[model samples]
Target: MPMSFYAQSTVQGTVTDAGTGQPIPGVNIIVQGTSNGSTTDFDGNYSITNVNNGDTLVFSYVGFVPQEIPFTGQGRINIVLQEDAAELEQVVVIGYGTTRKKDLTGSVALITAEDFNTGNNVTPENLVNGRVAGVTINTQGGPAGNSEIRIRGGASLNASNDPLIVVDGLPLNDPRDLSNGSRSILSTINPNDIESFSVLKDASAAAIYGNRGANGVIIITTKRGKKKLQVSLDSNTTVETLTDKVDVFSANEFRSFVQANFPDRVDLLGNANTDWQDEIYQDAFSANHNLSVSGSLLGDILPARVSIGRSDLEGLRKTSKFERTTSSVSLNPRLFNNHLKIDVNANLNFEKNRFAPGVEGAAIVFDPTQPVLDPASPYEGYFEYLNGSGFALNNVPRNPVAQLLQTRQIANVRRYFGNVKFDYQLHFFPDLRAVLNLGVDNSTTKRFEERSTQSATGFNASQGDF
Candidate 1:
């Protein structure tokens, strides 16, 4: 073999960012095929010894691409690294701004439409029930009713514990003022139209909204137009029935108890046996449908999505019902070769509701021995107590069946929510951008209550409208 001698020399170099030209500290610099490695200091300078001039040098760092350079007898070498787009992926929205998940230190969870729960869901919260950690969703209790969504639970005892709700950059109100019953906070939005939900569970992530976000923040992003023409329809029907009845005294059980405990009180029991709860509760059916048309328009420059939805929800309690109609128009278009992006969205919703009164108490306590109907009684033939003048008493509880059958409470609500967002990306600097957002939320509600002359609860016919 021919005699060969290789001299090991030290290589010193400075590493900086290619885009900002700023020094990057803590960068890993290692000689290829060897265990010798060194890290850049605060000034982005590093030195590696015991390395031949022909050996390759590898520079690696987080959020930046790695570089491999060969030393060709050069005493000093300088290298610039470009950002790795894959390592810096955009995370879900946080306070209307976005960043990489690795850079975020706050507790945040994102639920996309694909991860949502399936069924005839009545509210938007129902879609995310039990899907995300540190988030709890209490679904609607009745037809199109309200639900309580808590992020990391309540933080305060005196103030509101409800999280601030933002839909398409517009914050939604409590919705208690939107209808007579103030049904659902997210009832205006069709569940099928939602694209994703970003939940901020910690104080740091929700700090952008100030005190209103003390409980947390729920950001709802609806679907946008797609490039190709697409038509979507989501329809489902749900039937609701009482899972189980309360373990209350039955007709026979009540009579036997009363007779055994107090013989004198036995006179209060009647011959007929009635189950008040059975008479008040019934099976209910709800139907919902959403139709959407989305595609690119204006020579593929403007993409738009238009949707219409309708829901008819019947309460498990007899004579209670809710009906809603909603329409939405969304446009997301990029102009000037993708420099300017515009997001325009408008949503309109109309609702009609018939509220059921709190009569379950009377249903459970009402005498099970009395017959529901009396032919000779003056109170619409519904049995009731009579005084000396044969009039229904004012202080006594009314028949549960009679109350639900004779009373009518209705509300008509209309709401319009719209928002426009403009984002401009600098041509010179792709990472820098400016954003402007404008929004409006308008609502109107008309409610009325009417009761027949049932000679109970109220003796005369009464009506109130608001």
Candidate 2:
């Protein structure tokens, strides 16, 4: 029998502080040159399986020096990590420049990638939740939810209150641009591609941007390729059940109660109690898929990344559905031996929205005074078009099912939009960098609608584009 691979490896270790000989908690112990790793417990004991005799074990702590010790078939290895003071002096990137944690005069907070990555439906401010002070994040109801952000007590009385969003160096078109009382741009951005986000609140930090800086700025940095060959994949699928259903009365229940009250004129009340709204609504499901790839270009001349994503969404009502597809590609290439750098980025989006028709204004003619679907009369419906040269029944209307079936209405909209931008970076002087940028945006919207002829109620078909 062949020997199992798992039978040949075992690594165990204890982690303690070098300064005081006290047990260190949450020290990450990993086998060198491998993804296999484990953390120390509260008592500082850790065991990593599947490590061979020749493999090296590395001990790492956030504020301590990382130690690598060669393993020599030992059952137990003890390690102590010395605290690193320089790590505390490290500068963090703020709005304009880097600042040490203790030296910062203004308030600035940092949020790690691990904390914000948990939410699948993360909003712009969701990334900063609980990590910052004096910032409020508001999320409205529904799948196409709206998120409102306010920093340091909102400004402007009768004007817009939404925070400004800047991606890379470009100020994004108004967040309200896509908010036609429904959708917005924040929901469209794929969170997986985001590398980091910084919120600029105070004037000292935002004044450099000018004008729109009154509302503050949210700087978004997208992922870029590294020098080494690297490939990564992230996939998220969300299953959300229907929160509530449309209110409707059953077909039989609608008819029975009407007759029970007015037995003598039961037929007349039947048309008034018809369940039209119930017929047009149903439960729906939604889903989203995203794929992204990044890598170096030609081993150092350039680095690029491409990402594609799609969202298949449906409303609780059967008649409504929305689909959006987006693709983006970015390239940062060096010229003249890294002295000059150029960045080119482009994005394309395609969207489709559709909805079904419902009852029209003329359907109100359904009267309780007269019975619909008259049995004695040759014409089943109470109302009819061109009944003997402009003559017809007076009060009641036709069967709603037939009226709805004969009259079909569809609303369909499709849009295509994209942008291409180029930025040139010059590094000619020390402590100073300059940029020249030019970009063009192009977009087109098209709409098509169809309405079937309603011969019974004297409604006609119409079609047009907008």
Q: Which candidate tops lDDT? A: 1
| Per-prediction TM-score | 0.78, 0.57
lDDT of 1 at 238: 82
Model 1, range 264-334, lDDT digits (tens) per residue? Answer: 99987888889898899989999999999999999789999999999999998999998989999999999
Q: lDDT per model, in order?
A: 0.85, 0.60
RMSD values for the candidates in order, in angstroms, are 13.3, 11.6
Q: Flag regions of model 2 displaced more than 4 Å.
A: 1-112, 117-143, 175-182, 233-237, 244-281, 334-341, 355-429, 448-466
Candidate 2, residues 368-405, lDDT tens digits: the string is: 23333444433334334224333443344454444544
Q: Among these predicted structures, which one has the highest TM-score?
A: 1
Quote the positional error of residue 401 for candidate 2 in Å.
Answer: 11
Per model, state how many residue pairs clash: 0, 0
